[model samples]
Target chain A: SAVISQKPSRDICQRGTSLTIQCQVDSQVTMMFWYRQQPGQSLTLIATANQGSEATYESGFVIDKFPISRPNLTFSTLTVSNLSPEDSSIYLCSVGRRGLQETQYFGPGTRLLVL
Target chain B: SQQGEEDPQALSIQEGENATMNCSYKTSINNLQWYRQNSGRGLVHLILIRSNEREKHSGRLRVTLDTSKKSSSLLITASRAADTASYFCATEWKSSGDKLTFGTGTRLAVRP
Candidate 1:
């Protein structure tokens, strides 16, 4: 199991602003993922943050709006840009250990409220 | 079995009683994991049941997987107030890369 932590436990921001949420892992991992969860809703995968290449985003998400950077194996960041009221949601970072079939450990999540 | 679906979206039970939540998926999976979230917060990994494994246990929690039926269930025995949270079931298929498809989640309220 891996321990993951996210920065800015919760934040309130104004529209059009950008917020960068960082994720740090205790162990090096191969696959990192970003997720968004609206209030009372299930989580939706945003993108896959590979160590050395561009992030692979899901069909409904885009990089311009949600850019990701995974400089190394243990850390990654997700930035929600040009935020809108609809963008207000809990952003989470999860990691999958090497060879671990689908066991993912999630960070506490950064709760963003766009006003 | 349909992908990412759970039954009895909400459950309320008194402390010391047992709570059970069921999840059903559409495809063949390598493993299925259970997670718990407190008050809409981040999820805590509870347990995992592989496709070849029929059942697993962790403390007061019990998980069962039925690949033939493509479904799984999570059971929490002797519940406490702290157990009053949302529980979700996530699946990872044999061919899908590291992506976990999460279910709708069950809101369990353990009243004292």
Candidate 2:
């Protein structure tokens, strides 16, 4: 199992501003992912933060809105640009081994509340 | 949407009893997993059952998968107040690059 942590466990931001959430893992990992969980809703995958390459985003999410950077195996960041009330959600970071059926470990998550 | 759906969106039970949550997905999957979340925080993975596997167990948690029905279930035996949390089932779709599509969670409240 991998231990992951995210910065800014909870934050309140003004609308039109941006906030970047950081995820750090104790051990080097092959896979890093970003997710969003809205109030009273399920988790949604925002993008796969691939190391040394562009992140792969899911449908309904775009790079301009959610820019991601994975400079190395143990760290990644997800920035929610131009925040809005609807963007107020808990952003989670997860890590998994590539090409395996193993469990993915998650960070404690960063809860963002946009005003 | 590719998201899975969980039934009985909310559940309430007394401590020492059992609680069951069901998840149904739309597409074929390589594996199905169950996760637990407390107070809207990051999720803790409970268990994972592959497509070929029928049932899996981890301590007090039991997970059953039925590919024929495209659904899976999680059973927490002898539930405790500490087990009160939201449970979600995520699926790794075949050929989908291991990206998990999460289901609408089941919020369980165990009264002590």
Maximum-DockQ candidate: 2
Most lDDT-accurate candidate: 2
Residue-by-residue lDDT tens digits, candidate 1, A58-102: 888999999999999999999999989999899999999645675
Report the TM-score of the second chain of model 1 against its true counterpart.
Answer: 0.96
How would you encode candidate 2's per-residue C-alpha lDDT over A3-115 as one tens digit per residue? 99899899999999999999999999999999999999999999999999999998899999999999999999999999999999999999999879789899999999999
Error of 1 at B75 (Å): 1.0
Per-candidate TM equals 0.96, 0.98
Chain A TM-score values, per prediction: 0.97, 0.99
Clash totals, every prediction = 0, 0
For model 1, the DockQ equals 0.70
The first chain of model 1 has a TM-score of 0.97
